[model samples]
Target: MYRREYKVSISNYPYCNKKVDVKKLEEELEQDSNEQKEAVVYIHIPFCAEICDFCIYCHEQVVNNDKIEKYTNALIREIQEYSRKSYVRSLSIKAIYFGGGTPSMLSVNQFDRILSVCKECLNLVSDVEISVEVNVLNATEKKIEQFKYSRVKRISVGIQTFSEKTRETLGLPLKQKDLLNFINMMGQYEFPVMAIDVMYGEPCQEKEEIIQDIEIASDLNISHISLYQLCVIRGTKLFSRMQQFDWVQPDESMLYAMFNVADDTLQKLGFYNTVIPEYSKYGKESVFWKDNFNPQLDRLSFGASAYGYLNGRTYQNVCNVDTYINYLQKFKVPLDSISEKVTVLQKLERDIILQSRTQVIDTKYLEDEYNELYEQMYKETLQEIIDQQLAYREKNLIKFTKPGMYMQEDIAVKFMKSILEGKSRLYKKMVIGNQKI
Candidate 1:
């Protein structure tokens, strides 16, 4: 299962004795992977019309068609290579999520061919959830019309915020009229799930604006909403501006108010939090989120800077676009690194920590199966959090209190130990900072 991290450039062609090094991960997956045959596929489209100021995702501004054309070819080739694997071929796909930069940047024919190739080589369920993320700036009726006829069942729009002042502060190129028109135009189609992402707690944001955004989205007949708190990481334009202007963000109390307001509003609007930040009407839970993080399922990632957990291995692709294209074109695996998550303790940690975030941790099940491991790994920390009134246990599950939700990052970090591998191996830090949701 040894593989290059895509930053490695050693060979030209004949990249693998078996023809593709990326397949090595799959080949090894065939041998020792879990018995679950269902998988979720995530395809990353890393080109944006323009980069938002308050962002740090791996993306490049769309300058020309040449780069996109080359990247599409390489992406298709990467899919084909993975398709050839016995392990990949054996799985039944539960969902196919096309995330971005902005998946709408892809033309109809291009995405059509990509989906066609997937159909040609993979086993998709009769009612598989196929989702594509779009930017409001380019969520044209024509583009959405293409999706209506295609296999795409769920469409998520990255609207982030609808306030004109906040938009300007974030340097977002959005016009209110265009957004309204886009919404009206898109409303003509009856997609199963229509989602909008809303971010709050940004610098100079008002609580009422957050509530208004959610109210407007609900009024638009949108079926789903994802609420994310803005986090300005270093290297993003927002962080630079913050440093220059000493811009202050909303305090913890204000953020807490925003969360409660948004949460209460969505509930009153006939929506429930299917997961943290993701509110949905009945029967609209995102299949991608459900299956992608499921311990019983595999998540296979494609394209640049994608993170995946496949066959108990957590791997991330290199973020650089040219490096990704070159590695795949050269028949090499585009993995930045492949770390093992095959151990029992690692498996428990992955499942419990992720589960405890939005839902409850099934302590009864763990106590039944891994009593010793459970006591050693999480018992102390779990009890401490409960004593601290951050979390409480039900009959079998652990649920976070209101105070706990905001401090989940701290609680989760306490779960980390000087066990298998501190910062590497199976101990990779995932969302261990301030609660990402």
Candidate 2:
């Protein structure tokens, strides 16, 4: 078994202090003959009436109409600017996601205008999977109707928990009844697919509470669920309250219990394939699963503090509204950071990590496509994973046994240890700490 130790401080280097000139990056990517054309667009609408204490997303409290108008205009300008440079009008966009603060908070007119601008700029493919992330409180009949009229096919609603006590602790504004009513209305309309976002491991959450949340979701016949463990991101109200809370963040044992409960419960409810470590559903995993290769798909992000994956690289937009608006006003791309240009090695590692999390990795696929790289790492570290019983080779596939899945993060860290050390040999050795995945 893999040894469990105190969390090591894995340096977030390579990703730190990196910014890309959006125009330059796009040009470079466009010139790459090997670049794939399939694209996904993400629009960030960062206006929220109230910021959740646990939320670390780049968002602002918008209490005034003027600020909303200004933000919308800025978003439009950013879209227009990107369209001009990327020639997006001629490209087929496969998916468009409106996420953050509260995408549904926009007035119907504003939402329509934004969608219109996107259509004007990008050639949205017929049957493009359009999704909008909404806060339960902000969703209304008019908003849902407008979204349908705009051709939005998916709605990802944030309903972290159904327990009133947990909801209060989470500072969620809506009640369980309101959230259920919203889900019921969506079901009545057959809103293509409704995905519920749930959270676990909250400060005072009990096992029963989480199970109740799952039961409620399954009863509603929600098409998909994105279950996430509560994380203490650095600058959030929840982070500040972490100390005073009597509840303990689930330890490795507790996490295993939580994961098993959810997995078993969801499977019994006929939600089969685990899409991501935290996502699952009954039918074909959502549009996000297309192409099968996790990292190959493109993601375009909009809004304050939104991150997009495109052309084999990741870029994040400015997190502050004023900064975003200011940059757009100056006819510049509103970007804050461009994470490191992902190398082939990094891509392979990502695939390994993602596959390993599911308790399976296609060893033949790795051997066939990445023989040389796979051999090098297999010799160096893969043996250890096998020895620890975290992974085992089964014919052409390397699968993480049941016990292995619970400790997948630790295995990934072991792989990362070598890579990170090689990349920054002179830097101080930082260990991965007790942070939850």
Could you say which candidate leads in TM-score? Answer: 1
List candidate 2 stretches off by more than 4 Å. Answer: 1-23, 29-36, 86-91, 289-293, 354-360, 378-380, 402-409, 415-419, 422-437
lDDT of 2 by residue, 35-117 (tens): 33666777888889899998766688877778888889999998887676543443467877787888888889998999999
Q: Residue 35 CA error for candidate 1 (Å)? A: 3.2
List, residue by residue over 20-115, the lDDT tens digit for candidate 1: 244446568556334548888999999998998876678999878788889899889988887776677778998999998989888887888888
lDDT of all the models against the reference? 0.75, 0.69
Off by over 4 Å in 1: 1-27, 30-36, 418-437
The estimated TM-scores of all candidates read 0.88, 0.85
**Model 2: how far is 31 from its true place, Å?**
3.7
